[model samples]
Target: MIHLFLGGARSGKSSLAEALCHRWPGQVVYVATARSHPSMAERIELHRRRRPQSWHCVEEPLALARLLAEAGEDQLLLIDCLTLWLTNQMMAGACLDQATEGLIGALSACRAEVVLVSTEVGQGLIPDDPMSRAFVVAAGELHQGIARVADRVSFCQAGHPIPVKGERP
Candidate 1:
């Protein structure tokens, strides 16, 4: 089964995703997409502290589709933040459409149950900067594509989740 969690930053999206992971009967694998940076050390540490020690953590800055394709049947994966993953690929000069297609294809073939978290960035004002505008466009497209395939979808606001496309958790 595929589930998607969407929210603004610090809106308890990760916390809700982790809770769902804990409920899964299979082994939980957290596929972290953020790259470590000096400025993000504190935020990263917070996430580290939030996750249970029993869960296996994989820090993957790119090649998410490849990783998904390799998932074992006994695994349940929580891909924390697709926006960051998209950003990582975009900054690396990858073609956005091709990358997104590869990801959707890989996800369709994945054996494990999966849950994804992503920021809902397109709801806000348009950015003046070109790169930021591009990011929002990419994010919007990615979210829509995933939502089409997702078994469940929830939108978070003020730490509360309102079901969008399926049964509420």
Candidate 2:
């Protein structure tokens, strides 16, 4: 089953995703999508501290679909945010069209339970710059497409999750 967790900044989406990962019976891979930077060191450490040592961690900023294919059916993969992945792909000049479509295909073909974390960034004010606007629009498009294919979709706000589709877990 594919689960999509959507939320704003500091809205407990990661915590909820981790809880779900902990409940999974088989191997769980925490696929962190954030790129390591000095400014993000503390944040990354906090997340690392939250996860159990038994769970494997893979830091992949892009090429998530390829990683998903590598994970196979026996393991459950929790991708802790598509927002950063998209940004990295965009910055790296990857073919967004092919990348997003490939992701959907890879996800549909996967037998493993996949949990995707994403931030809902379209609800805020319109950005004045083209790059910022492009990011928002791209993110919105990606979320909608992923949500359609996801078995479960939930919105998180203030540490609470409200199911938008499928069964609550």
List the candidate 1 regions with Cα displacement exceeding 4 Å.
none
lDDT of 1 by residue, 1-169 (tens): 8999999999989899888888887789999999999977898899899888999999998888989999999999999889989999999999998888888888888999999999999999999999999999989999998998888999988888899999998
Q: Where is model 2 more than 4 Å wrong at Cα?
A: none
Q: Please give the lDDT score for candidate 2.
A: 0.90
Candidate with top lDDT is 1
Model 2 residue 155 CA deviation (Å) reads 0.2
Candidate 2: residue pairs that collide: none
Global lDDT of each model? 0.91, 0.90
Q: What is the TM-score of each candidate against the true structure?
A: 0.97, 0.97
Q: Please give, for residues 1-169, the per-residue lDDT of candidate 2 as tens digits.
A: 9999999999999998888889898999999999999988998999999999989999999988888787778899999889899999899998777778888888888888899999999999999999899889888988988998999998999988889999886
